[model samples]
Target chain A: MLKAIKGIPLYLLALFLFIVTGLPFLIMFLTSFKGQMEFMTSPWSFPESFSLDNYKLLAELQFFGYFANSLVVSVVSVIIVILIAAMASYPLARLKFRLNRPIFILFMVGMMIPIHTTLVPIFILTNKMGLYDSLFGLIGPYIAFALPISIVIFTQFMRDIPKELEESAKMDGCSHLRLFWSIIFPLLTPAVATVAIYNFIHIWNEFIFALVLTNSTQNATLPIGLREFYGEFSVNIPGIMAALTLGSLPLLLVYFIAQEKIVTGLAAGSVKG
Target chain B: MSRLQEISLDTVHVRKKKKNKDTWVIIGFIAPAFIIYGVYVIYSIFMTFYYSTFDWTGIDANMVFVGLDNYIQLFQDDVFWTSIQNNFLLVIASLLTQLPVGLIMALLLFSPIKGMRLFRSVYFMPFLMSTVAIGILFIFIYEGNYGLLNAILEGIGLESLQTAWIGKESTAIWAVIATVCWQFAPFYMILFRATMVGIPEELYEAADIDGASGWQRFKSITLPLLKPIIITSAILSVIGSLKYFDLIYVMTGGGPNNSTELMATYMYKQTFTNFNMGYGSSISFSMFIIAFIVTVFILLGDRSTRGNG
Candidate 1:
């Protein structure tokens, strides 16, 4: 009992942070279920009754279209990033070449360059390529910005792969492509998961590129779509809350389901740098 | 002797041919990522600089070469200066708040406190939610009249402290800064927690044998070991704070008298909102330079400290 008393302050601090971090989400979630009248009448109180009206309103407003756009963009970009970044990492991790060090440094430097710095030129390039205001336009820049870190993670993982596997394959006359496909690439499951999760989260939540490169509602990703909801539904606070809740749901759901994968993946991705 | 020399020459020629083949293979592997990264990142950086010299609005072909005039004007622009100041202020505020708060939270996870799994899951949830959602949610939370923050203050008998948190110039930046900390501190917590978990158990056992207290153990062993990750987190926070957008843009649009205007937000308004593409490029390029310089400086300082230690 005395030891438990000594632990009270620790529990208090933990609970305080819990409320600080978790309360806003609770309020957002609970407020999402209240009717407009209830929300306006007593904003902090528990909802008198959980209503699906706000969610139904979102459904009528084509909310799922934004989800599809975000899904397509994130999936396509992550797949391409994994394939090419892993391919590039094979040579970078194992090969001896004149430009290897310089190339690696160049990609690493991309991490520090502000995305805003590349904004104007990419906008122009997208326009000139006739890809402006389209989902396809967002993919190019997404793949580009994701390469640096993806390569970093991939190369770090690849270096640990045993050389004996490659040497034996080479003795069987396996070409570099075949060697990579048969040996190196197969050994990269953990790294691929890490890259995919890290990039998926970033691209799914990406704002500036989507905001700039795509202008139409059909092409708008979730972050931009949520902002659009905010503008149109400003007076409808509960409805807006519902949109925010639904918008945040997919990622929160994924995080809960695969909590360890994401936590370790993100840590691995960043701690390497 | 001649036959031996012939064999040696033949082997050398074959090896050279293999080296050439390997070069082709390497290029083949690297070309796709390099092309994409080049056009979007490297090429865009140079183009940003090139466009900064022009007087063209992004919509039209009427490009007038301004020859560094935009940068010169940026130097004199009051809003630009204010935005720069705010960005630095964010950097400092984030370092001070996010890192320490993250450390405290991570430490609490390892404490004898109950229900830590639940605590950790909730702690990390804020980070998973999109930043735009956080910004919009907090907008209402900071809303003056019916906002949760004000209501809570009133409920707790702190009615005088309540106001439109983001509506006033004085409180706006700090309010957004607090929100920023809320969203990101958990990320740093994960980083610190991962490092802390890797710390060997024997060190604490050794400390206990010497009668060291909890704070003393943390100070002597944990803090010293945490130095590398702390530096890395600081670098990330500083660069992220400098280039911050989206949340600030969504929440305030850098408003209530432009109090929270970051470089990125200001650049967005200038280029996209006002069609000052040339000037916006300058601001963004300046951001690039500032981020680059700070990263290099931190890395160098980190390297030198490592050398001394």
Candidate 2:
């Protein structure tokens, strides 16, 4: 009886936190299906009837196009960042070279830089290169910014693997490229997953660069599109909420599926630092 | 020659060739990341510094340089100062709220509890959602008319307390900070929990044997061991709040007279919205410097704490 009584406080506290954290999302989700009258009259109440009109309206507004744009940019950037950062990190971790330390430090600099610091120059440079308003323009900066931490995470992960595997592969007449592909790259799967999720989430949710680099509807990522959607549909609360839900649905799905990886990836960055 | 000597001679030659090849291979591997990061991020930082010396509006490259003029103007700018102040306020608020609340959540969830995974995920939902979505959700909750918050306040018979949360000058920054705190507290909770799990069970068992109260055990064992992560989270929070932009940008746009203006949003407005590229670049560089200095300062504090320990 005493133990049961003691457990009550913890349960209550947990329940309080769960509601405090989850209420906004719950409200957003529920209200997305709510009609104008339902939302206006009973803001805190559940909808009397579930409605698909808001989602339909959002679909008509080319919400899927923005979703696709975000996917392409985020996926492509994640791929490029993981590949190049992993490749660079391998040498920094395992090899002895004159510039290795300096190069690693250079990548670390990216972690410290406020993205705004580089925005104007990168904007001008991308525009000059004729990459402005293109997905590729966003990719370049995304890959660049994602590199430092990806490299750090990958390098730290790589340094821990036993050197014997690589040396044996070398002694077997396996070329460096062959060894990396066959031996090292395979061992780096965990690190790759961490870097992949980290970059994907960041790039997927990123707004500033997407906002600055792309101007056309075809090029706009989810965040930018959702912003415009909100602006246009401000009066249509349900419609705006539908658009916001669509924008967030993909990432939330990824998070749920890879909860451990997502949590560890995020914690890894800070803990390692 | 013996077989061993013959193989050794051949191996030496091959090793030298491989060494030479390895150098090129390393260079090849590092080049892609280096070139892209160099040209875009690193070089852009330098460009920001260079542009800070000029008076160009970013429309054309051909403009006269007025060295330090933008920096001087930035120093005198009240909005700029206000933005810096807000950033510090955010840093303080994050340190005070996110850390403690997160630590409490971590401690409560640390033990074997019912539906721990569910609770964990629920707590972290805010952190997982896109900032834009979170911002939009908060905007609705903070909406003056037919908003959730006002509704709740009214439901609890606090109708007089309901006001424009994000529209009023007095409550605007605090409202945004509350939203930010809500969004990020889970991050520290997860982080601290991860660290707390690594803590061995024997210490807790021994403390329990000693009849140490839960708070006593937490204060003596958990807080002391959690110090490193605590420092790290503090630094992360401070640096993050310093560079924070997205949610605040979406929700407030640093509005109601720029009450919630942050260094990042100010830089964005100056460069993109106002076309004061030079002055904007100056602000950006200053942000970079401030982020760097604050990170190093926190790290130094961590070092001092470690020394004492």
Instruction: Please list all clashing residue pairs in model 2, or write none if there are none.
Output: none
Q: For residue A74, what is the lDDT in candidate 1?
A: 96
User: Tens digit of lDDT per residue, candidate 2, span A4-70?
Assistant: 2267778888889988998888888888998887877776788888889999888888999998999
Residue range A1-273, candidate 1, lDDT tens digits: 112235878899899999999999899889899887887788889998898999999999989999999999999999999999999988999999989999999999999999999999999999999999999999999999999999999999988888898998899999999999988887899899999998998999999999999999988999999999999998889899999999999999999999998998898888886
Q: Candidate 1's C-alpha lDDT?
A: 0.93
Off by over 4 Å in 1: A1-5
Per-residue C-alpha lDDT of model 2 across residues B130-159, encoded as one tens digit per residue: 788889889989989777889889889999
DockQ scores of the candidates: 0.64, 0.59
Local error of candidate 1 at residue A262 (angstroms): 1.0
Candidate 1 structure quality by residue, lDDT tens digits, B1-309:
699999999999999999999999999999999999999999999999999999979888899999999999999999999999999999999999999999999988888777999999999998888889999999999999989899999999999999999999999999999999999999999999999989998998888889777888888988999998999899999989989998899889999889999999999999999999999999999999999999999999999999999
Query: What TM-score does chain A reach in every model?
Result: 0.97, 0.95
What local lDDT score does residue B114 receive in model 1, on the 0 to 100 scale?
A: 74
Q: Which residue pairs in candidate 1 collide?
A: none
Give residue A188's lDDT in candidate 1 (0 to 100).
93
